[model samples]
Target chain A: MDTTSTHGASPGAARAALLVLADGRFPAGGHAHSGGAEAAVKAGRIREATDLAAFCRGRLHTSGLTSAALAAAAAAGADPLALDEAADARTPSPALRATARKLGRQLMRAARAAWPCDALDALAAARPRGAHQPVVLGVTARAAGLGPEDAAHCVAYESVGGPATAVVRLLGLDPFEATAVLARLAPELDQVARRAAEAGRRALTEGPGTLPAASAPLLDITAQAHAAWPVRLFAS
Target chain B: MHLDHSHDTTTAVSADAARPDGTRRALRIGLGGPVGSGKTATVAALCRALRDTFSIAVVTNDIYTREDAEFLLRNAVLPPERIQAVETGACPHTAIRDDISANLEAVEDLEDAVGPLDLILVESGGDNLTATFSKGLVDAQVFVIDVAGGDDIPRKGGPGVTTADLLVVNKTDLAPYVGSDLGRMARDAQDQRGELPVAFTSLTSGEGVKPVADWVRARLAAWSA
Candidate 1:
């Protein structure tokens, strides 16, 4: 699965652009969050590398796929406001909703500075409190001259990558082992991204209703519970 | 729904001279130091000392919990609305130095919520000697180290020790017990920092936090002028 096929005429330059956007060190405030891993760790669900892999795999199929589809739709030039409402409909927990919007606002600040697009400006103006993060991610990808598939990959990777890094700190799981878990899941990540992009392409014809609606109940419940915590590590 | 163009349309990215409405934003000063160096205590003292003259707010970057924020709140240093706690996800330095998106959001949110403020103190979680505030996050920074941590900290200068706008050597009251040499530490700091300022303090003393508070007032005056 060669995911790094440069989209533009200048293949090398386009490839480099993808690298910059997708790099974990992009400094978009993803480091402070554990993508539900912190909750799982607190619950004693993830103890070692294997448990982490299983947890990540489950999240990848659910929240990961959903975020990927929304991102792909945004990259394909869908309406961000409509997608934002769709995001709200999917996210049941108020805490998760707040987290999504907060992260979205922070991401918008960084993206606007990097890409400097009128569309992003318009979106930022439209949702001053911030839109859903996946919607913003897709729009940012579009601003960077990337396509739906690239946006899908970006969200999908972040789905597992965030948890992996966080689990390293939370559980002291071997960094090598956590990274290996991601490496092992690369093939599945590719599949999820492709399906998300396909769904995104369909969204233009049908509507945002065509996008995937996958949810993990435990994750949602735990996220709400975690927000009430007086003391916790990750923000979400 | 269009955002109030006057409030939200800030075009300048880095720590700008003015808010989007073209009014001068509050002067932001960051306090960073090693663990147990009394950065929070200093912040509390500063708030108690300067709140009468300035509309003050605080943002604390804590690694795990909201301990620092809770400390200020419990002490009643400022009203609850004037305080914000940012979670750094165990990477204290990242929030202050490397990727400052979270800290920027906190500061801006505080300003938007409590407008027309005069000063905002951004307190970093206790970190290593290398941690310093990014120019984008704060206009100036103070590095705090205590004699108990080691009088040798100044001699082994890192970015925070050598480059901060103000370096505070705290807990001079414990110098004798800790076998720390205040004079030698000052000399080493001078040798390392060449014209930057340093202050020795013991929070228990009446005038302990006075120098740092006065320094902040001077910065605020300069910022206003």
Candidate 2:
């Protein structure tokens, strides 16, 4: 499934496109966390707006970027098999990797049911065990007929999905404040999506079987410790 | 690949009444309830009962691991492909109630692969009485409470018990041993639901799921019609 044409949708369709992509109802496992906001809260890392912003921003760049890049590449109609390997290499923490794949498989199940595309099967069958979140996102995006930008934003949204939910639960913050946080951060949405799209293009533009690997040990270490805790509110 | 085309009404052994266009949506039903109240048994039984009636699929939500899906597969309740797991990695309530994206995706994928599906059941992992299926994740929901959980469960008035499309009082066979009166539960349920229906069953003995299945079948008919 090397298909790669997006039909050059009109600008007027952009709003609808964003709506479909950003709609919390898209069903890709974004509801599982508060973007590490829960973990951050547990760690005493967040208590107010400014702290939440920084934590969300950092996560947006790390695991968030890794997953988004892979999804974007997938949306571009790249090989899911290749994307899986690439995503696996970038997610080094065993616990985090496992969580990513768990979410990935769950995401795949929903995406396959909602939109029947060869890419979905390709992704599911690509690996003997489990595929990574980015790969699943990328393949699903393509299957859904979304552009790379939509794929890019979808990935960024995943980062926020979990953390945003955590905030409401953790702080008892009103939903209005949460939306305000998201609205103020809207500028970053375009920026992060653009970068993610570029990263995805780079991963796919490389030779077949070639992929990037995880660079941050801090995340892996934190995930390991987080997993060992007796009680944790988030998966990782 | 529209949602309306019906094709696998008879031939497809995997799913008895799947739609024709493989690229369509799965019919989603949700099972939610309190902890240790036979939610797993209900899910396994539904898979067995409906596996031949539709292209059946399941998504299990365990708090920390993919245990429930593993349990069903280990018991051979459904094929490995037909069973997937979602580790909520959080409160079980969050996945089913507040945030439902992951569960929704699983339902869609099952439909995508062996679809157009007749049904896909999302099993909520054991949790407190507050757990209920999100409207986005399921077309209709079955709230499973059991005699073991106590007859007061009916009067507890959680959204799951009062508002779910169908309410199931499981483990009726254990009522005598557990000292629960099914008649009292019926009265309490009636007091809360007004017109919504409730069925009492003992999954351990396979005593009462037929009515639940019939209700589900009727919903599927309406969805496809």
Candidate 3:
């Protein structure tokens, strides 16, 4: 992803951006969430750090696909509205749709002052239309003048980080251990983002690729169960 | 609206809207607080109080459900299509804060679906004291706390109480029943918010949502002006 600065970009600017985007404390409202790890873990889909890694890998394939598609589209500079619909149509379960929108909304907001891109600001104004996190992530990165590679990395890192952050809270895994797991995943992240950025570049000329039409059935069912509860730890 | 102005950030009206562009980009407001803090009720009451005077749309977040949107739809609080729901998968805050793409899309979609709306209310999913909307998400935000959470909640000052554009201490009607003192709560809130406005309401009794709605109206006027 060539964000390494042959372009006058500095390590300080990158660190500052990371502080705003990666710090979980940036006030875009991430604290209330457990990043779906709680529900997945409760459903017995994950058990240990290995399971956590595996679950993240699966997500990189499925929900991860959903998010990346949107990000890639936005990076190619596609229509945010259409990207949103493509995502909405792809996410069938009402629960997942809501989740996407909520996070999508927060991402848009946080990106506003921090990233300060016209696309991001315009997206902020367009609401009630619904959005996908990937598209917003792409647009935000673009707004910040980060190239496709940086955008891809941000998407992959945040996607991986969300669940890992949740696991630390849910399992009381050592923070250092969690950091180790995340650090280990960096290579895979680079691989995924690099591949995706190429795909994104191709799509820029192709006018955007189609998304997977089917939503995961088991995911919808679990969300339904979680929603009906009167008392629960996670908001979603 | 025509949405004539074009920029990378703004995805203007779809190909079909009749109104001209650059006419009006609706004012957006966000409402947030702990769950059961009367967010829906505030939204519902706002619709009832102000719909006739302004064009409005709603975006409601539910962590794993569309229950808030459904509630509005069932009550016919607004047209079925006007109210949209955002699901925050793990943490409600992430949708509103960390990963807000989806919610932004929803708000924009609602504006596009209707036309030239004057206001949009993004209701955050129930959350803890720390939760607050990103200024990027909404032009202004309303943090909802209630007497039931404890009269001390205001005094315990969190960002929601201290920094939100407006603060609503809901469930004021419960004060007598809960042995809570509303005056003390109001004073504590006043101490925390300084020149910012605060309102007390009992959504159940319909005691005081109008002032909050009016507060919203003023901000919308200020934003659009």
| Best first by lDDT, ranked | 1, 3, 2
Docking class of 2: incorrect
Can you give the lDDT of residue A198 in candidate 1?
92
Give the runs in model 1 whose Cα sits over 4 Å from its true position. Answer: A1-13, B1-3, B6-12
CAPRI band for model 1: medium
Task: Put down candidate 2 lDDT per residue, A30-129, tens digits, no spaces.
Answer: 6664544665677777787667777667777667766777777777767677676666677677777777786786676666666555556555655423
lDDT of each: 0.89, 0.70, 0.71
Model 3 vs. true fold: TM? 0.66
Error of 1 at B110 (Å): 0.8
Residue B93's lDDT within candidate 2 is 79
Candidate 2 clash total? 22
lDDT of 3 by residue, A201-223 (tens): 66666645444343456656777
Query: Model 2: per-residue lDDT, tens digit, B1-225?
Result: 213322222211112233333433567788888877777888887778777877778888887566777789888988898887765746687788765656655665576666656778888988877788877567788988989888898998878888988999988999999899999999999998889999888776665577677887888889778
- Quote the lDDT for B20 in model 3: 32
TM-score of chain A of each: 0.94, 0.84, 0.82
Superior by DockQ: candidate 2 or candidate 3: 2
Candidate 2 vs candidate 3: the lDDT winner is 3
**Comparing 1 and 3 by lDDT, which wins?**
1
Better of 1 and 3 by TM-score: 1
Local accuracy of candidate 1 as per-residue lDDT tens digits, A1-236: 11222233221124556678889878788888999999999999999999999999999999999999999988888888999988898888899899999989888888878877777888887887789999999888887777888889999999999999999999889999999999999999999999999998788788999899999999999999998899988898
In the predicted model 1, the residue pairs found to clash are none
Per-candidate TM-score against the hidden true structure: 0.96, 0.63, 0.66
How many backbone clashes does every candidate have? Answer: 0, 22, 58
